[model samples]
Target: MKFKVVEKFTSINGEGPLAGQLVVFIRFAGCNLNCSYCDTKWANKDNVCYDFMTSNDIYKYIKSTEIRNVTLTGGEPLLQEGIIELLELLSKDRSLHVEIETNGSIPLNEFGHIENPPSFTMDYKLPCSNMEDKMDLNNFHGLSPRDTVKFVCGTMEDVQKSKLIIDTYELSDKTNVYISPVFGQIDLEKIVGFMVYNKMNGINLQIQLHKIIWDQNKRGV
Candidate 1:
């Protein structure tokens, strides 16, 4: 199977609980949803960095990076058919920690059954993204404690909606939940204040560390 690889580089795992670990990032092209706050708009566009390659090619390239941690990200990585095959190949190496970052709109039951399921960072798009209507809440049941659900909020309204979902799913008790502010859109101070006022527990706030170290718009870093 051929994978539409838009960018391949190494960087720190930028969000969720695994924020500081170094990782080899394989950013695939194509997505089913368009979020207003999306930073990788270049990868979301048509004909983006059209370098089609196979899973072995990706595996070989990843080995050359000499990094043990691997992350599969995307405009929406799962939208590509080869991702499962690629993931299967990558997961064979028990030494490498494989993680798959996916928007919550897609079904995840398959991954749940894998022998060495890659740890998941599933994103539950909030109202501001405009694609929240497409989110499949049932995906939450597919998560193990090893997975995390992230809500990217750009406004107070988004945070409010996120709280309701959190309560409905008892997400804080279910697994790791994260509320990340859309960079430059929501103030970090405001997010912290919300957590403090509510005495929020079981959930944590995360920032994209790569953006902090390098220019937010810089690619392949």
Candidate 2:
């Protein structure tokens, strides 16, 4: 299987519950949604620093570096046609723990064919993202506790919308929910206050840890 890779490098798992762990990042090219606050807009465009790589090529890089965790991030990795084959190959080596960062627009059930499913960090776009209509809540129906739902909060409206969706779907029961402030847009404390005021449960506050630890403007970790 051929995978179009935007870039690959080693970095901390900058978001979600695994914020500080070192991991190899496999950034794929292509996305189904274009959110307004998207930082990686270049990845959505037609041409980027992309290379067509096979599963062995990716594995070799990982092995060379001795990294055990691999994050399949995007431009929505699931949108790539060869993603399942890539995941299957990655799963064979039990030493590696695979994680996928997705937009949550695609149905997780569609990936049922992948024998050993990787943990998913699913982003549920809110109103502030200007892509609310694109999210499909049914996709969260069968998500396991190992999977997480991340909401990028750019504005108060986004936070409110996220709360409604979280409650409506009863997401707190099956998975961990995360409310991450849009990098550089809103104050983290303010968003945390909102979460506290609402008495929200089972939700964690997160920031882009890599941006904090390294140059914010740089790509490829």
Off by over 4 Å in 1: none
The TM-score measured for candidate 2 stands at 0.95
Model 2 scores what on Cα lDDT?
A: 0.86
Model 1, C-alpha of 201: deviation from truth (Å): 0.7
Task: State how far residue 104 of model 1 sits from its true place (Å).
Answer: 0.8
Segments in model 2 whose C-alpha atoms lie over 4 Å from true places: none
Q: Which ten residues in a row have the lowest lDDT in candidate 2?
A: 108-117
lDDT digits (tens) for residues 1-221 of candidate 1: 99899989988888877789889999998899899898888898896766888999999998998999888998889889857888888878888888888999889887665678798889999989999989988898767788899999999989888888988888888788999889888888887888888888887988888899999999888
Q: Candidate 2 residues 131-170, lDDT tens each?
A: 8788877888978888999999998878888899899989
* TM-score per model over all chains: 0.96, 0.95
